[model samples]
Target: MAVKKPTLFAAPLANNGSKWSIGTETNVMKGLSQFHDPLINWSVESYSIDSLGESIALVVRNPSEDMAVTPRVDIYLVSADNSVKPKLLTGSFNAISDSPVFIKDGKKSVAREWDCSPESIVWSANGQTIFAVATDQGNNIIFAINATTGNCTRMTDAGSAMGLGTLGENQLLFQYTEQNKCVDIHILDIETKEMRRLTDVNSDKLRNVYIGQAEYFWFKGALGDQVHGWIIKPLQFNTEKKYPLALVVHGGPQASIQNIFTSTMWNSNIFANTGFVTVQINFHGSTGYGKNFTDSIKHQWGRYPYEDLMIELDHVLDNCSYVDKARMGWSRWVRVTAALVCHAGIFSTPGAWYGTNELWLPEHDFGGTPYDPKARSNHEEFNPERFANEFATPTLFIHGGSDYRVGVEQSLAPFTLLRRKNIPTKFVYFPDEDHHISSDVDQIKWLTEVLLWISEHTNTTLPYNLNQ
Candidate 1:
């Protein structure tokens, strides 16, 4: 079989410019425009290559402060050229070519987007047709457009793109988002368009749930009337064992925690492997849901969602026989503090120093303030302060010292209050870390420490010596 040559097209750098400029390359956004000097405003970049060695097309970015999107991209091509009197092609909204393809001198031709700023094509497969997944006006869609004619077709419907992607040949994989925060994986026949669901691996009602492998069950959003959530549980969950539970409140009050691929968990398999059930709720306020749900969470921050968490906890506890109602976040935070008080582990510190076998991976605590609003859902519902004083869970507070999202301060507030209540608690700080712990080594070590803490307090058999 003969090997085909590589298909290469002009790849434009959308945001490349001088260092001092608030340019695309720098990813700097400014509310004010003043590019008369050393590039204080104006983002810039361009494309100047062609496959034929003769320049065919050109792309450039020119930014403006008037619009939310800076530096609108402008595309052009070399219409014609001569040694002395050369030619130039320029157009916005649409570009018209002066020559034909292959038979350049035969007829006039051109291709362009119906709306210049609506979509940007960075890559394309399947001939000259460019395919992309785009979210516009609160709907997600897969669009295929002709590179030559600029005509387009929208494939895949809203909600259907939630868990969609490629797996292997003749197959496309994806998950569907359910109203009450449920996600299910499905496979579509590329040729037939016939789709089959391989697994509802994350459903609470399943027997062989793909623990930690698939997205967890979705729950009603805390931020909205009918939003959803994604929940993760332990890998080797024992129905008989009453395990510790954690509701990882992710920030991005507007961003629904999607379950596609996440390195953010920081090798969280350790959490499941260690016998703890972790819940990551998309909660209300997440995107993916329509604008109504996303915007409902705008003014109402901490309050409504915590109640949502409580309700979900009750639902899980009632359904899953193994989850101990006594074994939750508030309880965990306090229990750990009590262990320190009673000096429960004589060998805990020693075993903890033993170092971790798993590789270090960074992690983070979830949650953040929603879009600024003077009004909140009855401060009582969202006030962690009130709950913090009474929280008796064996909780370990882990946060990024530099996290601007929910801020390390959020963790500090709860930890401080819980400590005052004489609740079991430990607040560990990763000095240079941010929202999601990025350093693998730190995550592993942090997780190991958490495991040891849980083991010692829960009366499980884990290494107590830090050196173990």
Candidate 2:
């Protein structure tokens, strides 16, 4: 059987005195363009040419067989003259090269996921070093890699570096954000490794606002690995009094909740300001730790992550004496909402094939399709529907009717099951919205409902009137 691979074509243009003419075209790299392995898939994410045009840097992505595993990313130096094959400059590391901008809606702000892309690379003036950004632990770190030796050195401290740009010859400019602070422009001196803020755009807007204090902590996970998480203390927090806990589960089972101010939908400060302690665990499958840690969730979804969450919760309860263990509730993003479903095992429903738009997601995470004989056991084992009989917690189901990623049926099915089981559950559906509630009105409604749900279950008072 012959395997068809994506071909990279290049067209050179030559200006013949008066007009431009298409010269003889050719394949960019011929047979060496993509990974030849039949089992693995690969692609060229981005490419850069040196100032002299003698060398080109290419970011290649070779995804793993398991979807949970971070794709192997490498920087290859290819000579323009085609005298030699592409040389591997850097070894495989989880690269988060794309820097997404922060989104603001009224007073609420959101930082989208640190997408992996080519924008993450900044070539030094001489083209001798490549400064790239990657997620480490929970911070978006910048690393200066030697173009020749591939020796990498960490550049920035603890914060999320959103995007990078060249600043003169010695410094790199980037937008950075921390858990307590909003996004600000900062400059990094690659030589001395000194970073200073260049702009404080939100200082005035936040001068009178109260933000929660975030503290990072780690505990032994299900696999005995050090799982990381964050705990945000409520506004006007006091050690003498106990506060309700809101266990917020991040989406992307593959993504990690970093030390950055996120969107209004999942903002930890919202809960903190509402007099609730907010906790977010990175769990086993979450990225930024390492490839092994990210790959640990393969085929074992719902198992390891659930175990890690429970274990981390226990750790928090044991250490944070001011947390009211009895008054605890949890909320999750769309995909991992299954984590909550796993808690009480929802009703048996069709697997990922029925509602999920991305087929590769289940194919990669579940080991195979739902109908595959070998994968059936895994699909059944991790399916939240399999555990429907165990559900006891009061739940609120929110879904966008137009959501193509995971159909609204995913929520409706569970909501129906919970209703049948006499468990308190509410379904909040937005017909016009997509995966995320984006509009200003919807955002307000979403947060209001979420806070109301948690307050009702935990017996906490709303910090402010939602009707206003």
Candidate 3:
């Protein structure tokens, strides 16, 4: 690495075979045999290893940072010694940084990225022929890539609308999704164009479908509704007792809250099994619901999505009698009021004022008053004021340090305002996390807090690992 200005870290690659090296755009190359120094003026934002461990470095000529810029890639070779080596190709590689694939031979190149990506290249055993499989996304034709010609031909287009898998340099398998009413084992095979159905469920059935999840429910929402939700209950379910429930709102007014495993809500399981109900809602405007529903969020982002969540809340609290709403109580409401009133605390940029509230459209205030009569123009008024004077229920607000959605202010605003109002509100900030705390330690620590909340509020024993 050259003595360049401070750099923001990106994706990483490990140097295993020592056949590759790194070169900075500053013309400073690493891993040279000391035989010859090649000076080619080019810059690379980052570099990574391919599945084959070939020496492919990504070089982006000039990238724009002023706005959302598309990512591009170029591949290079390196020698065992700590310096850039012989060139393979010097032309454009069509691989979009989204799934970049640049092919190089001697001094030329052929690049490829996908358009409606369903068909993809699966590595063949010899690394000579890759699997080319396509489906509704187009086609999947497995064959060989002339590492020399940059040309490709299909081996098994089978024409069965097959799902492609690479068993080796020349082998592949295809599968598909199935339909059941509600089962645990989720198997999706787009390459094979198959669908599975979810059938029955019970406590013991938990082990079968949910992989230890005691209870799960699927809610199909209404009202511009393409919305869906998943409720993951504790592995230990007690039919006789009620439990505290949480409504985790996935942001993205345009992004769906998936039932699959993800870092954002990885800590959800801890609370669920500890006598607390963990619920995630994918509201109306969430993506994966189709284009019409997604586009609805545009221009009118906050209002419609908020309505969906409110409906979701109603769905949870209404049908589920065992839910402990008192646990949600007043303190949480107060914090929410604070967020709306003061726009929560800021992050990443500018003053201590927090981010969300600062971006609150300036047109909100009417009559030059902090408590504006116009705030509830279209929204019904349960209470005209933002933070009711004396509220109950201790509330905790968490935010990823780099979360732009809802902004750090969204969390902070509620906490700051609620605390100032003499409400019991707690705020915890994840320093290394953005939107989702990707680190395992940070996730466990977060799980601990929720566990404590559950143990204190609900009549359930805490997990042993969290006892520490």
Candidate 4:
């Protein structure tokens, strides 16, 4: 079968004088023009022409090729004069050349994922170098390419570039994050590639409150590969006193939790401010590290990654003596497949609150990939229904009725099973919401219920707002 694809083509400009055409003429065009070879498997994402208009740069994504969850993005360079064919830029991989320049700020303050994209190719004043944003080791940074020598030099590393623009002859203006701080303006010298901060937007306001301190933790996984995670110490934490621990599991099973200011259904800062030590583990399948790490959990959903999380938990508990082992609680965004598996194994844990349960419905959880009988059987093995009789830990299941991604029925099934088996379970479904409860009213109610459930089960109470 011939695969149809969108191909880029260019045409020459033509001018007609007043005497050249006296009547209206309609010409029939039938033939097609092709720029690159038809055998290429990639599609153009975005394109830009250099300042001199000598070469054109194409941000292309290889649909046939993928790394972990997303496709492999590369830049293809072609001559605007049609002198040279399109060639993939050397040393480019896992890049988001077509990503939009958005300010990744939180509601309360600016965010840390301050990434910026220059107009594909921002030719230097001398037109000798091209500056752009590229992803490196999960973080996006500014990069400069020597157009003539083909040498690539990194420009900025303080934080991801949120916005980019040329300043003067040798300086570039951009908004970026610094360390664990919020977004701010900075100047980058093109010649020296040195960056200097120009603004501190929220420093004074943030100084009044205690912000959670995040520290990176690394340990060897089951396969001897290094695993990474972060432990956020509660505000005004004291090393002498034991603190309650809350473990957060991210969804997508394939997605990752990077070192950015993130505030979603599972907010680390909220947990920290509420007097609980928080931990986020990027298991074997999380993105950003590399293709190998993301693909490690392909078919082994609840196996390897679960072990990694357990190992990570053990390491944190052993290293952080201030974490009260008896007061540990579990929480996660959306589907809680990994948490469900581990929660079943850990009977001594106080309680677990999973925002969504995707275990019973494997088709929805795995994006309808259970075609063969064996695959369906494997799904049954990971199904929480199998252990309904043995489920003892009190678990709360909250879901959105309109969540078509992972239907509310997924949670309903397990919730029913647990209740029938007298496993102490609660189900809170929101009919007006979708995969996520967006409205502030629903969000407050959801968080309040979650905190109340945890407190009631763990013998610890959070400062709940009665007005909410």
CA lDDT, every prediction? 0.45, 0.71, 0.45, 0.60
Give the clash count for each candidate: 58, 4, 56, 4
Best by lDDT: 2
Stretches of candidate 4 exceeding 4 Å from the true structure: 1-138, 143-159, 164-169, 178-180, 191-193, 332-368, 463-468
Q: What's model 1's TM-score?
A: 0.52
Worst ten in a row by lDDT for model 4: 344-353
TM-score of 2: 0.76
Weakest lDDT window of 10 consecutive positions for candidate 2: 101-110
List model 3 lDDT by residue over 149-213, tens digit each.
55755444322224445443323455422111222322223345233323233335435443234
Model 2 lDDT vs. the true structure? 0.71
Model 1, C-alpha of 306: deviation from truth (Å): 1.9
How close is every model to the real structure, measured as TM-score?
0.52, 0.76, 0.52, 0.65
Decoy 3 TM-score against native? 0.52
For candidate 4, give the lDDT.
Answer: 0.60
